[model samples]
Target: MAAALAAAAAAAAHHHRLSSSSPAARTRVVHHHHRRRRSSSLSFSAPASSHGCPRGARALRRAAAGDGGGNGSGGVSTGTVDPAAASSPSSSLEELYRSCATWTWRGMRVNYLVRGEGPPLLLVHGFGASVGHWRRNIGVLSESYTVYAIDLLGFGASDKPPGFSYTMETWAELILDFLDEVVRRPTVLVGNSVGSLACVIAAADSSRDLVRGLVLLNCSGGMNNKAIVDDWRIKLLLPLLWLIDFLLKQRRIASALFERVKDRSNLKDILLSVYGNKDAVDDELVEIIRGPADGEGALDAFVSTVTGPPGPSPIALMPAVAARSPVLVLWGDRDPFTPIDGPVGRYFSALPSELPNVTLHMLEGVGHCPHDDRPDLVHAKLLPWLDTLPSTTALTPVSSPAA
Candidate 1:
């Protein structure tokens, strides 16, 4: 009876020890499996550290291995890791915001935005427009090239140095200076409306060798003599109309002038769309439009360009550019400023037919600034053409030239 009692007590004690060991061992295996899954999910290749063991198991193992450093603490302390250091590339793009810089050129502070990365692409906005006009194309173009959109002198964020003559030649020189100093490279010069004229002049000048190609969008340089004569009549009336425009600049007068057309809705929408976001079309932008209306010098810049001497006359320069560089002319068929069927078309048609480097594309249902209205269409046509051009077209060691 004494022996039997002893054996029963031993069996009970062994069963108790087995029950406790099995649960702990099973918990440790589950814990290790969970850690492995987490590591795999994070793509972490780090070796499993001693801490990879279950909370109490690591301490138990350490104690069993005679390592006195590990106390009987049930909790496991893991070192902290930086989350930012493990962040993805998309997070870097989210941190990017549009930035601007001012550089001195011909004693004028010209403001420009340099965004994205790749080959250089210089964008010039037209009259009554700021760099804001290029908002639609900026992101798309930035994908393949570093896009620099600038506010021409006296426009947008640029310092309008009071009394500075805003002639096309002067503007052209300013752009050339900008190209030399800010866009140090042979850049693809893309210009719209009056800006196109400036780009043409710059390209015509032998000094602007950095201009690799020309993309003129709904250009105004090809103005016919009859249009010039008609515009002169309006300029003669500017002195009398000046007072009315000044008083009505902020009021409905500016909007009324544009609203007189049959396509008022489209025109109004286009004007508002240039702001990109409606919030940007605040009192400040309204003031920019009114500045030229109130100032006599600004009025002269507009009048002189249309009726005065410095207006865009492509006859002299177009022939020269046609001989040298690849000139891609894009005209909006429905352009109100420079109609395809009007004097502008006649001027372009008069160009030598056999010119090998010149190409003309007529965009349907687009207006004065196709880059703003139909950027995807413009980009679709542009990218393919650019691909065909020699890879050496981009200037080497790209840097802005001295103004």
Candidate 2:
């Protein structure tokens, strides 16, 4: 049985490479820029597939509070709707709050939000984060793109079914499935931390070319990645991880540990530790990370994901993905979880030098979640790069239904 499983995994990896191979020469560029912006050295070449995509340049007004409503069958609007526009920040929040909807995925309730209208851009949050974590960026991004943010199953308001073994690959599959069943179109996937790695896997292994482009923010290493690292610290850390894994299997112990971890104060401290801009760790952010912990199966999901076998590593998947779609990597230099100086960060820092289809940007003073930690700086870089993408196809606005 073990041998059969290994063979299947090997076959899938080989298929991923074969499916993603393209004859076009890849273009590579790397920029290590800061928030305030300074002149930086650059070397660049155009991607093999660069072409004009018909899209309006005018900024879209945020959908008025009472103007939009979802049908609840994926809550996607088909026809063009010019809902009244509001310019205030409060209205932006109102539009976002009113846009909430839920989708049933594999007998599980998955919470999601869709806003604005244009080509689809899916925003995936990191571990323990949900749709609300993208609160600061989604409204602004939705102006130019139809933004879709989902609470991955087991996180946020999504159903967290107990005893369901969680793996990075499982989340990746969920992402691809969401693209197929919910979005129903190719999309540019923007993900942070482990979410970024999931997007990488989805883009690499997708059978239908569902992913158009990838924007990764400080992508993380797999949970079991320590097994492959040659460093002495990893050698020591592996045993500790294994010990924790064993302890977490005890329901009582897992529940107790989870309780401490999810405490409001503890969550805030954890957030502050990783956020480069400490001020970004506000009460709302803390609540966003804390709200779902009370769910019935949250503890099981947390334990399972923490102890699960490492799925495909981004380093192994990026080559296949870059061959088929352009990749934009944004790393937060101040991140502690996947420290910029760590093996994973170093690998991404150097990836663009080898793969022409990959572009790397190191965001100085930014922590793990660059999108939330410093949305302004993130937008400054992200918006321009998005305009230059070769794969843009317009889709009708999918107005979010009233909450």
Candidate 3:
């Protein structure tokens, strides 16, 4: 049977890791401050399938989505913000991104949303996405657990300080620091794409084990573009990446390109192409992504992130984090940016068998933004896993401080 073969393959991979001190086992990631390293050889483009912005990746996504058509598979809605205004959907959506609270991080105001009052849950969004991306799940998830969704400083209502360095390690540091200063309790980190990678890095490198569990939704290969440089796709995308990087350096061109990509029409098309469930691409979703572009340093952040260094890969960070906290991976098989068949996806697909702490569920017919594309499915698996994690109150070290 196919399942038998998969089990055999997983067993062989696990055996290989056991044979030698696995690269994953030996890899010890430290704070980005000390170990801040970037990929120099290849100016690889970020995965085309992520949320939006960073011109090159968006273009690639359009091409990929064109080649790969979407399906009508959508999750049933669990609940809406306001059922009374169901016919006029926008009215219900308006109630989603309101009542936000702010927290100071490094002298800048970082926007966040907090709700229910049980165990804490920190939601981190992918590149070009903000807390509004979780509009559907926030209300539902909050009913059982205290949910906190942050804008990650550079995106959403958070401070977009121009010329500021944006890297996965920096975001990871922000998450860890947020846990220490803000949450101040053991919390579950639920992240998507680059957000997931940031959580992995934070959980792996932090001095304290403030994270109780991890829910990774299609974790990305690297922060920016550079990841596994040897992948055939990266080799093919080299010239395009170079060209885009060059164009982004020019202020006028960068601004013009940013303008085009952030347009509501373009965003809808991009979202449609990547999402298996096309109905989920509502006007509010487009506004959530588009509204941030008008910010003071938004354009600069876009260019810098697209051209910036690709931080540490999750492949190298997961081993340490998994050894400490339970990990639940929910991947949308239809993702184009980090396709389920790609290097990052394949690595995670095999992880659950290799490590007992990991659990992966390939959401059938889902796309890159699994959380939003099919909240019903993501919640079905996520909510149960979260309930199973043992509650913790103290700050214990996640990994050995000495890298």
Candidate 4:
């Protein structure tokens, strides 16, 4: 159900030619650069959840015993996957899963984990996803940098209270707070899909120096609304979105829908739809995603996120964010929702022209979440770019330019 709803959100923004006074946006040929877009909320601060592994390191380690226990928080090992066959040769899947941790924020548990050292790097998952989503990249990136992967509030082990708004601003605030209170450093944020939008907002935040850099993978164009700009995609999907948005809001109905989609078979099918690499959509991956849906607040959070307002698009957030920080924009050219040939793609293609500091890479034949679908390809491009950036010690001064 979550995947279905998320797909709708992406569809609405597929045809957008951003309402940019920028010359590039104005001249963007219709259907030439497809860009698809696809967020949450609440208030009050909970006591600082221990920045340390919340589930406790020992409990997480025990998850390696088998998938029978339901205790793991945010790593793929939170379920079970053949450690031998994972993408990273250096670390087993079970070891990665053992890193799962939990933090309390605003009266709810937020699941996350940390690994390695050096400058802090945080991974934010997209809609219906958790830290486990980044299993492939975390182990490799952690070799040189402290890699933190978290299940956003209402997803994974995070507490999902009823009545949360589930908007972009909501998640952005949480990201900022997590940086200040947990990682306790100005850090680079790497996000996929909706998570990318949250990182954009966090980097632009006026209140904190939490984000030092950003990497957006197959970034969503909008939050939860239809196309923000004038486009046929909006006209085409508005009615369908209206229906899904309505159906998702009902409690019993939402739960029923969740049950159907959470089925292992249904889950695999949905994953295959978005993941371009057919081989990667294995049973373990499906179980990892399905595992979180049964947890508390999962259904409610899904409904809220699905029916929620569309947050600012990259067009809306990029100018200010790019001025303050360097951004690496990655797009899977084969993304069905936001084809590289669609409006979203055009917007990204035009980015380098507007912000010379921005680096954009188009991955051929990949889908919505390139980081997960092709970790090797993503890392091949990512690590080199990361090396070029100044050290964390050098980054703070750039963010503030101390007098």
Tens digits of lDDT, candidate 2, 1-403: 1111122223333333333433322222222211211121111121111122234653332122122221111111111311111111222433444566776655567777776777889999877788888877876777667788888988987778766777777778778777766676689999988789889988987877689899998888874444236545556656655566676665555555566666677667777778877767777788877788787777766766776777788888888898998888777788766776778887887887788777776767778888787665566556766776765543344322222
Per-model TM-score, in order, reads 0.59, 0.75, 0.76, 0.76
Q: What TM-score does model 4 achieve against the real structure?
A: 0.76
| lDDT (tens digit, per residue) of candidate 1 on 4-97 | 1112222333333332322211111111111111010011122211111111223333322232221121111111222222111111111122
Candidate 2 lDDT (Cα, 0 to 1):
0.66
RMSD values for the candidates in order, in angstroms, are: 33.0, 17.8, 15.9, 13.6
Candidate 4 or 3, higher lDDT:
3
What's the lDDT for residue 18 in model 2? 31
- Whole-structure CA lDDT of model 4: 0.65
Q: Identify the leading candidate in terms of lDDT.
A: 3
lDDT of 1 at 10: 29
Clashes of 1: 4
Question: lDDT tens string, model 3, 1-403?
Answer: 1111112222333333333321211212222233422211111122111111221233433332232221111222233323222212221334445556666655567777776667789999988888888886776667566778888978998878766768878889778877776676899999998899899999998666688989899888886545757667767766656666676676655655666677677667777777777777778778887898788878766866777788898998898899999998888888877787778888988897788888777776677888888776676667756656877775643222211
Error of 4 at 91 (Å): 5.3
